[model samples]
Target: MVRARAAVAGARAAWIVSGPGARPTMLELEHEQLGGSARSDDARSTLELSRGIPLANVADGRRGVALARYESARAESASLARALTIEVRATLERVRVLERGRQVFDRLVALDAEVTAAARARVRDELITPLTARLVELDQLRVERRRATHAIALEEALVERIGWLGADAGAIVLASEAVEPESLTIAEDTIAARGREDAPAVLQARARIREREAAERLLAREQHGDAHVAIGAFLERRPSETATADDGGTRELGFRARVGVPLPWGTIDRMAVEQARSETGLAVQDERVVALAAATEARRAHRRLRLAWSQHTRDASRASQIDADLVRVREAYRDGRIGLDAYLAEKDRLTESRLEGLESELTYWEARAALERALGLSFEAIASGATR
Candidate 1:
């Protein structure tokens, strides 16, 4: 009986081990298969997503390229504005110089008119010869003609300045001021340094070009043929046969994912990048050289002109003073019968010529100063204030 009980207990334990609850059901098997498929689908989707290009990088590069272009345009505009300012100031200064000279010529012409009238009266009264009167009239005419010609030149200069300032021919009236003496001491090294630091338009243009080229390189790097990824899902329904109990149908679901990359095959873009880089480098070196050479040439020329003008002005001023002193003595001698009217008239003419020369030299001096200002990219006011 004990052996029979042991065999029965062993059989019951075996049956319990292999019961329906212990075995996997059909629903559970289906769930396991679906879980495995879902895991595989997730992996495939992840791989596809990972293959996509970094579009943000490309967009950022493009923005950088645009910004570089804008910077180039802005620099060009600024350079143009500076050039215009220089032109305007130079022309205005020239107008002032010419006007001052014209005023001196006007005074000389008036004196000539008085002398010619006196000589004509003396001839009529039989006190002077007709030839002398004729000579005096001719001198008067010459002086008037010179003054008229100078006036025309002054008007033309004023018109030019007005046009540059964007004003109507008769609308703008520039303030009249006496021309002041410019500082005679300007260092060549200081001028060159200032030009390089703030006035070299070519250098600014070259830098802009370099920035643009660099931006282009960055854009090319980002846009080098990109990879793409795609994922899709679809559902389908199929009718079953013997659908009498209900509208029996089978459902199917499918998923797919794909990743692709462009073939690395193109030398044209690479060549373009190299070309841009080379051009940028060449511009940096060549533009700087050209600008520096031009600045040096202009500075030297301006310096020479200023020196010559200063020397001429000093000599003419001294001569004018001498002529003025001689004129007083000659007039007294003519009044006391110690000299003739012709000698007095001749002395007066010498004085007029000396004054004209002095005025001309002054004008030239101012013109030279203006040229130096343009070359150095600094005005007299700026220099006086110790501003760069």
Candidate 2:
């Protein structure tokens, strides 16, 4: 937002500079004093105001370069805004994913505690070896360790979110907010179109190209050179040659005007014109490079998101199946049909499967966010189908 505001301010300044004007290249006021050599001499004073005007720009193309800059700055401001929004959204989703993952770890730790208790009871009853009980305790401790690690990561993610939002941590509440349960799917053509039309990098590059072109035109106009004109009125009085003479030596008051126009000399700064042309060509190439990169990234992100969603769906199904298996295994272990070790192993597998599913979900969201950035679409807009 700060960057966006700065860009907006620049645009405003450019617009103001580009306003209609026959701009004065130079303005001067002069003062002069003249004195005669003898005591009877009279003194003369003069004042003048003069200005230089660029004939080439005065009539039509005045500040054309500034006008082009204004347009470029306007586009840049919008691009900065879009980029800022994408950053915020991506950060928000990262925090959300980390929050969800923390919850999963929380559940895992609780389940590990229950399993450890059951393992200790089986050991006390002589149904399980002490080594087996120790293994369960170790597993429980590892889960606790992992939960601590996850807590640290979650805190870091929340801190990052706070910095991005410029908000207090207390104001950020995510537990009550429901997770995005489904993936958003946008058409490939829509993504491509958005990349070309709205992507911040592409837009900025194209705007720069236009800016360079305008600069070239302004430079070409400038080659005609300014017309320098100085017009002034002066007064002069001189002492009489002899002290007793009736007539003064001299007295004159007159207006003087001087004008200078450059001859249509050889090309003025051919190198500068060529440099401007080269810069414009480079800007064009830059736009193409940016456009190609945006298009490629948009396609790649879209594909990754599609793959993530598919993986999430498969993992979700596998987790559900593991959950069913765990229920049956628990029942069998209670009835003595399966050993406690077997039940514990199945429960561990269920935990792994659940974690896998959660991770897949996170991957899907990450990919979705990447795609949104590449296409220069906000998550809110995508979710609401605003672009569609």
**Highest TM-score scorer:** 2
Candidate 2: TM-score? 0.71
Q: What are the Cα lDDT values of the candidates?
A: 0.57, 0.68
Alpha-carbon RMSD to native, per candidate: 16.4, 11.7
Off-target runs (Cα >4 Å) in candidate 2 are: 1-53, 58-62, 173-186, 227-261, 266-268, 317-335, 382-388
Give the per-residue lDDT of model 2 (tens digit) for 1-388: 0111121111111111222455443333232234423344454434444455676663445466677778789877876777777776666766777777787777667666766777778878998799987987887787788778878977887787888777775476544222442324557766666776667788778878878987787777777777778776666677676646666677778887879887667464756878999999999999988888888887788778778878987886686676567566655654568775776777677777877787787787778778777866765665565652
Task: Kindly list the per-residue Cα lDDT of model 1 for residues 327-385, writing each as its tens digit.
Answer: 56444543445434555566566655665565666556455545544453544543462
Local distance difference test, candidate 1: 0.57
Q: Local error of candidate 1 at 23, Å? A: 53
- TM-score per candidate, in order? 0.67, 0.71
* Number of the top-ranking candidate, with lDDT as the measure: 2
Count of clashes in candidate 1:
0
